[model samples]
Target: MDETAQEKKLSAHNASPTQASDHPADPVLSGGFRFDRMELAGAFGDLGTLLPIVIAMILINNLSPSSVFFAFGLLYLLSGFVYRLPIPVQPLKAVGAIAIAYPAVVTESVIGASGILFGAFLLVVSLTGLMDWMAKLFSQAVVRGIQLTLGLVFLKKGIELIIHKDLFMSGAQNRLAEYPVNLIIGITVFALVLLLLDNRRFPAALAALVVGIGSGLALGGFSTLTLAFGPTDVRLISPSMSDYWTALVMLIIPQIPLTIGNACVGTASTCTSLFAGNPLLAKAKAGMFALTMGIVNLPAGFFGAVPMCHGTGGLAAHYRFGARTGGAPIMIGAFFILIALVLGELGFSLLALIPRSVLGVLLVFAGLELCPLLRNLKTNEEYFVALLIAGIALAVPNMGWAFAIGIAVDFFIRKMNVRI
Candidate 1:
């Protein structure tokens, strides 16, 4: 996007003339909800990142959808009230992807174990001030590198969702539509989103969902729908050493860098830039975010909910789509709470109503939202490190390895006084 368009996308509300919100954080000033068309549209901004993973885990891992939904709702609520911005809550992408790809090794229990284990690590870093010390180790170039890698990853997944058409590796047995049909729906929604993306009167996300849901219903979304009220029975988690081992290798190591670098530090940076001058966003710090994510997951491990994070991509999605105040997360949170209460695990069937094509559109935009952040990189050396990190992560398809390489390279560059 050009500078003007990027500015519009980052503005508090696309239609509103102010960078500060209409309520300007409201009667409380530092924290409150502001309901409006923009906030409503922004509410579902990250569903692209959310629904697929949860549904797949529920189907593949046999975790309770009700508890997953409930956990998400509560987490979103916490993000809104505490952060006072439309920051987001999402499943750990690396962990979710690992479980989905290798269900045999990374079972539901393994995922739950990851939640507990990683949550504990986050607490240690956050509470004991280790996060501050660790934060110093990650240079801006490395952080941007991490964010760039994720943006590219989202873009890839978005494309796959479009082409595969069967809920990320669901295969021929579960493929929903033929290639042509999938293409048409995805293209139509994508075009519509681009055209109406900045329009306040008819918000882009809301419009895209309307088409998605309508298309899904037309394709027989109701035939499989059944009411199954939930927050289903919670089971006490008792993961074995093997489970913890798998969780650490496949989920924790691969994913923890993201929660710390992007979710915590990178998101704090995004908040400072996007919500500058807003008092409500003043406390949006890396340590606090680290703590909040641990809080999001500790209770989750007991019920086998997916591990959660405050991904910067989700925040970019909300802001790009017009979320301004706390209302956005609250709106999405309440919606999920209702889904858990009313539809329970069966809500997955209903969500299937919205086609993968539509969801792909969401993923594409959310990924693209991160592009602007990269423009902040100034020096050639910073750009080189960031690009190298992104290339290694995407090429290896392993963030854990990429992060280690990034740190070593950044340190070498600083020590050698190397000039790119």
Candidate 2:
């Protein structure tokens, strides 16, 4: 079939009522709110993406856990209500990676400023409808390429997490070599995930978490567990002019292309793919996405919240498990709020006890969930462009550069009528 015909067929399939109502439960009739086992399991589907950054910011940058949790919880709660879907609020990966890798160079103030500046930028673009305009510029091939690249990225990270021991754990002894305990755990969880992928009665993520926590406790990973309740100290962060400038140049500038490509365009595309028949869930435009970022980050920046975004990966992770409505984020948000208000520092300790192998299994499956989009490529040229973008993205370790190069190559090929 021709590209146009293929596109039409896919659209038709997505718009079918059967596809829309394929979830284990009808979200619309359920009042779009569910706190069942599947929803709770879906809540942790993106923990592999969330916890590392939160822990890094707290441990390395000395950011207050309570404040961060509060911001995270608050945003998750707001996003669920506003989007009325399983749409997630995730830490911006670009900013998190840079901040975590170079803690000395990227201070808390710098991170805070990056959030504020980026928030303002998104707000302006969203208000001006520039986001919508930009979103239209990318072809389906480009979007698919971005998804493929991200899937591979997640796969790489998941493997790393599985093979390596926890950073907090002592003894440089390799977990894979010592007794292959982590490897065994990873395989077991992976098999379990596969087995339960389609079983609504059994939530794979929740089961994985249970196994992970159980294994951690057996290994004496959590020596002590304490719960403390107190007023979280949330202080206003006022970045100086220099700090703002530095963040704009160093952090925000580098992140803009990624924000545009993955957070906005890719996310919107994935929503359409996943919820093809459900107009309300599928029609996430770039402007709406940017607005969410602006709304969440504005407060997050001022209060030292981890800068956040709604990315395609997070959405896929949530859907891969069992989340079918806004209830997932609401449930997770409430959990975070409780942690922030009651557990505070102790929350980190509990998170630390979750075996890295289990988290790795989750990441692996999340990555796998995103791989289906690649099957949409119709032509050899399209496949070439997508593969090129994925290769470049992995090699350069930058999605923005990959996107730019892919677009240029695609344009050149089309203009020249080059049949590769």
Candidate 3:
């Protein structure tokens, strides 16, 4: 066989159970996992989602970086093993954003209780199969709309990060006043990423990280490397009655809708779209998605670790940068574990070395990857529904609301027998 024929054979053989057989499996399945430099780079492709929230929680909420890193690392490894794909574990953005924005109002106990309560809720939903029902409620139009909105959000954030001086040091500077040197560096990195995107032998994300590190070092971003071996003081925490109450009313209530819309429905749709030929891919049902979040956050909550979830954006980011197997998460997970162990207290200082521009470029491309999914909408009616949902999602900046709106619009259109 020629190289192309051989590649086709490998792909067909690796198709998930759903694609391979008429009947799909009940539980989530995985494709074969491979560990390589490409997978390693794919692991870090979603840093834009992980780092910002983590940094904020640590700085604003006084959360322990060691505990957060450890939880994230351990969970990522487990997710890869369980899903057998590049399923990403990411910080719960709604909770993280709320906590960061209102640190004075949101207490640590509240955060911990939120995670515990949310985890339990998800666990029950998954076990009872309620998540499967919920997943079915979202139409393809709604899912596509959510994906587009998320892609745009990431893209906008990426552009912001790229133009800024540095995430930590920059205050309010001119939008166009970035140092000429930094602009040059950003342009160079962006160009390199675009050029190497299709080059399997040289993963673009890996190349970007290498260039970013080199540039950061040369620019004195890491003038001193402080490696510490001090023991971390993370312990299991039990939430109080008040903490649970606070979490239920404040955090859990707002987060549930978002989680159901994005983490469950959005992620499952993305997986199926990407791996259509694999029957096992269909096993990435809403219940399984919920189970992963519940398993990760329940224990992590006790230790004040940042709660995590599987996100469509993170999945797209990983797959966009050449991550095709379970090995990608495992590789990245091990790196996080190493960071947690070696730099228990000094984690923030080390992360500070990464340049904002490089991360921006990565986010930009990851967002770009998601845009192609919009093409899946075949009808003008589908496009109209999708555009409506996308508009609502972007305008209100609430994915849950947008999801509901999209579904309602789609239903109404179908009911009216509207033809475009």
Off by over 4 Å in 1: 1-16, 21-30, 165-179, 230-233
Candidate 3 deviates by what RMSD? 5.7
Writing each residue's lDDT as its tens digit, candidate 3 over 268-316 gives 8777766555545655777898998899888788888888889899988
Q: Please give the CA lDDT of all the candidate structures.
A: 0.78, 0.78, 0.76
Superposed Cα deviation of residue 277, candidate 3 (Å): 1.0
Query: What are the runs in model 2 whose C-alpha is more than 4 Å off?
Result: 1-19, 22-25, 28-31, 167-178, 224-226
**Which stretches in model 3 have alpha-carbon errors above 4 Å?**
1-30, 167-182, 223-225
- TM agreement with the true structure for every prediction: 0.90, 0.90, 0.87
Q: What does candidate 2 score on TM? A: 0.90
The TM-score measured for candidate 3 stands at 0.87
Q: Tens digit of lDDT per residue, candidate 2, span 1-420?
A: 013444445545533242235543566334467677777888889987787677777778767777788878888898788776778778888888888888897888888898899899999999999998888766788888988988888888888878764422322233344476777788888999899876678889988988887877676665544455553567788999988988887788788888888888888887777665454644477788899889878868887778888888888898788776788999998888888888875675677677677878888888887877788787889899989999999999567899999888988888899897
